[model samples]
Target: MADLSINFAGIKAPNPFWLASAPPTDKAYNVIRAFEAGWGGVVWKTLGEDPAPVNVSSRYSAHYGKNREVMGFNNIELITDRSLEINLREITQVKKDWPDRAMIVSMMYPCEEESWAKVLPLVEATGADAIELNFGCPHGMPERGMGAAVGQVPEYVEMVTRWCKKYCSLPVIVKLTPNITDVRLPARAALNGGADAVSLINTINSITSLDLDNMVARPIVGGRSTHGGYCGSAVKPIALNMVAEIARDPATHGLPISGIGGISNWRDAAEFIALGSGSVQVCTAAMLHGFRIVEQMKDGLSRWMDEKGYASIEDFRGKAVANTTDWKYLDMNYQVIAQIDQDKCIQCGRCYIACEDTSHQSISQLIADNGARKYEVIKEECVGCNLCEITCPVEHCITMVPQASDKPYMNWTQDPRNPRAVAA
Candidate 1:
């Protein structure tokens, strides 16, 4: 079996799967349970000053699919409502008990250096492996000039990260907010401030749905609703892109990354690792399923790695970064056409309908002598957009076959059609 262990920015874990800081890792009971279920680490839910923050009633809402599956999760909740003293005490005890598992504490405080200065020592004394600066909470705490408010400003990100680095001996992981226009700015700021690693993407600012009858957004509170942090499988693409951006950017390249947002399975975790995440974090998946899901994640990842002849996580980590390039660098001469397999096709006209109605008219409908409807791709008109393949219900029914080409590889930067093409 391939080794799943990782030493992510000095915080070692038996496996790369760690529970993100959320409701699941809010307390010692939860952290202990998660460790028992095979999770390699836990970023204890964000802690703050002594009083803690008051959470609102009806803290959660969900965006569901047709089958009533949660596609996205929304929460208007604040940081840990429990007192800081209680939290620190619990963390100290938990870390003492679970010495092998990674014990990372997530914290958010006012932008002031004093606030961070005051809390860093207390948390450091808890024996936690590292401290994650939670600069990414999208809703409640941002109103108090913390969370996303601080994350949105690059200057604040650099300043606070510096404070943590200055005041604490533990590794500093800057948790970045997705609410910003450009995620790389904050990532670069974290690097500039001497952060050991960066974790992302934090929840996005979103209102999942509305209560139509009550005339408010959800999760409703006293018939009124407010925007909340949105996360889950729906945000995976956004998170992957942001991670890639940071990994590929010259300014932030090689900065350790703990990939977060919408990771549910081993494949998702593997994708993040391939894109340069040293470790991957989970939250919504555990909430939807349970801690035991980490078992499946570890098993699947290990089996796949073994099949691919990988001996360890580092062997494949960041393997995809080089291929993840700008659109301008993509090959213009390469082409593939969608091919429909008649044997695999369930005679579902979804591909034909999607292509003919919305996309290019690249598929033709045919009526055979037996009165059976058949759909075939129009080789001439197909742009190889894969719309037909995407809409097809059956897996492997439509495959894009690359055409053999003798032409030299050419990109937009070298194409004659581009006015700004580099001089030959």
Candidate 2:
């Protein structure tokens, strides 16, 4: 009922949900279907030079739950395998037909200004709204001195971003790799080099498993396997933390963010917005489900927004940022302890075992007045570490109860461990 329109880096999208550059946006055909399914936009799959060849079939493997929840997505796929000429032609046609949809092109190549200068004009010529430099692809291309190689170096991020700014008239969105010690460094570099926006986090380097039986892992070649970049719901926490870090960094304070990695539903999208992402991007979710999933996401997000009385997308975007603070600034008095409901407990002493072995020994098992084995939280020793809550099988069975007033402080407010902490 309310308007879902948003302007990302001066480009308009019907909503804040955009399909990330992946197989879904590998070509114009897929993007057209995605837009028809209610997706706001698509970042056309990463394109490279005139001729780029990637691996054959079986380049992808996924980890999923029985209920169909996509836990993780792994890819050895390289940049666009299509020729540059054809990709440009298709991009031109797609933008012409879907003028209202945001069309941001993702591209990667050698870390050369000439290479970028040569490519930018052609991409802009295709009438794309913006350009997202693909500096974060962790597999296949890194050995060629592209992708994550360029992304890992802050100086290279700055240099490459500056090249795009110099030649590419359209807004430049620098895609960041999460393989660094702290994401803030490269984020700062992108902003410093005049990037209009930044998108993250690219897949983390991971090796899912080893086939001990066959002595050859998946996506294997020559009886050995190399690590691939990982995506999907499993990486959501890592992506969120990195997004928050970039958003709060003073160096990249006002830069627009295109949030990527592990977005399946409207709730995840909303969380990214709260952490200061202007637009949310999806890839593996759509791959697992059909394009129709966008319908649910769009409707659900709209309904939730209406319920929250947000007249528009920007109304609630980043509202939670004001509440997020450095460790030293948090309130020290707030505290909560795990409270397990007897009815919800399955009589499994997992909570007690976990608490005793890895956490505070606050759980006590004793015979109840009714002569039943019962596990109770020792009010005196319970530190509210939350290990029990996490390992619980049932949801909402184990919850944390806030501490009483006049107790010892619970938070790390005025963190004595921080070097910047004011010496008392």
Candidate 3:
């Protein structure tokens, strides 16, 4: 079996699957339940100064797929509504009870250094392993100069991160917001402020749906609604791209990352690790499915690592970063065409319709003598766009087959068609 343990920025955990700071980690009861379910750790929900903010009822909304499966989740809920003293007492007890598990406290404070200076030591006194600056809450907190309000500004990100490092003895992990124009700017800023590691991406600002009858957006509050922080499976692609950018960035390269956003399964966790994440965080998945899902995640990752002959997470971490490159660097001479497997075809014309109507006219539909329908790929016209492959209803019904070519490897930067092609 492969060892799944990780020492993420010096905070040790039994595995990389940490429950992100959300409703699931809001209280000691939930955290203990998650630990019993085999989760490696938890970032205790975001805490603030005394007089916790009061959250409204109907704080959640969901985006559903054709089958009514939740594609994403939106929440206007703010940080922990419990008083700071109560949260701290629970954190102390939980850490003492579960000494082996990572206990990271997530916090959001006023921009003033005095505010952080006052609260940092109180949190540290809990014997927690680390502190995560909750700079990415996209909804309620930002209205009060916390969350994304601070995260969107790189200078504020650096300033607050510096304050945490200055006052707190535990490792500081800066949680970054995806709402920014350039995520790398804030990531580099975190590095400059002496952050031990960074985690991302926090929920996107979104409105999942609307009640047309009432003319209000989802999670309606008295016939009115406000946008909430969006997260879940739909945000995975966006999150992956941002993680890759930070992993390969020259300025912040090698900075530890705790990947977040839309990670639903073990494969999602593995993908994040391959792209340079030291560990992975989860919130939406745990909310959608219960905590027991971590069992499958752990089993699948361990089996896969054993199959790949990896002794530990570090062996394969960031292995894919070297191959992730700019579009201009991709080989332009590579060629592949779609091939339809007749035996596996269910005679579904989805591929044909999708290609003929919206994409290149590369799939040909034929009528057999007996009045049966058949679909075939027109190789000469196929652009290898994979539209037909994607639309095919059956698995492996259409595969992109690479063709033999004598041409040398060429990228857009060296091609003659480019306006700034280099001379060979």
Candidate 4:
């Protein structure tokens, strides 16, 4: 059997699946239940300085797809609302009971050495495996000069992380915010400050819906709403690209990454590992489905590892990172054309309509030998854009087929089309 165990930034766990710091890991009750459900670890919900902020009612909003599936979720909730003393006591007991599982405490404070220095010892007493600097909460906390307010500034990221490293003895994982234009800047800053690892992304700044009738946004409390952190399935692509960017960057290469955002299944976790995540974190999925989801995540990953002839998670981890590259590195000489399978076609006309009306119009309506109206790709006009394939109803009915290329290798950087190429 393939081993699911992982040693992420020196914190060992039975598996790489850890509950992200959210409602799911907000307290001892939730963390204990998650452990019973087979999760490898939990990052205890973010703890802040004493006098925790009050939360408002109607704190959540969601974006739904055509079938009413949750595309994205948004929330304006603050960090752990419980007292710091109570939270530390619970974390201490939980860590003592679950010795084998990784317990990481997520913390935030004002950007001052005195504030961070004071809290580190209290949390360190919990015997938790690590501490994650919570710099990515994008809602209420930012307004108070905490959370994303600290994260958006690279200098503050480095300065605060340095304070944590200075005062805290445990491994420090910097949780990054994705609202910035370039995620790598903060990632590199974390590494510069002696962080043991990094996790991304906290959440995107988003408004999930609008109540046009009331002239307000969603999650309207007393006829008012504010932009909250957006998460869930819709943010997966954005999260994946950011992870890859940090993993592949020359300055931050070899930094341990705890991948979060939109991971719901074994495949999702596997993709994160392949893209160089040392471990994976989950929140929105657990919120939607329940703690039992980890069982399937563990079992499915093990099954896949067995089929792939792998011995452990490390054997396949970071395997896909090599293939991700810049657009300029792509083969300019490569060519492909879309092909339509006649037998599998249901004549949905979706492909034809999509191509003709909005796309390149590379697909044409024609009469087949059997006198049936057929949609076929116009070979000469097809740009291999795959828009038709994306809009097609039948899976595998339309595929991009690679054409044989006799031309030599060429790239835009050095090609004649490049106006910025330097003289060699």
**Top-scoring candidate (lDDT):** 3
lDDT of 4 by residue, 348-407 (tens): 889889889988889999878997788999999998889989988889999999999898
- Tell how far residue 32 is off in model 3, in angstroms: 0.7
Model 3, runs deviating above 4 Å:
none
**For model 3, the run of ten residues with the poorest summed lDDT:** 214-223
Instruction: Estimate the TM-score of every prediction.
Output: 0.99, 0.93, 0.99, 0.97
Ranking by lDDT: 3, 1, 4, 2
Clashing pairs in 3: none
Clash pairs, candidate 2, are none
Which regions of candidate 2 deviate over 4 angstroms? 64-69, 368-371, 407-424
Clashing pairs in 4: none
lDDT value for candidate 2?
A: 0.88
Comparing 1 with 2 on TM-score, the higher-scoring candidate is: 1
The local distance difference test score of each candidate is 0.94, 0.88, 0.95, 0.93
Candidate 4 off by > 4 Å = 367-371, 422-424
Model 1, range 19-74, lDDT digits (tens) per residue? Answer: 99999999999999999999999999999986878887898999999899999999
What's the distance in Å from true for residue 86, model 4?
A: 0.7
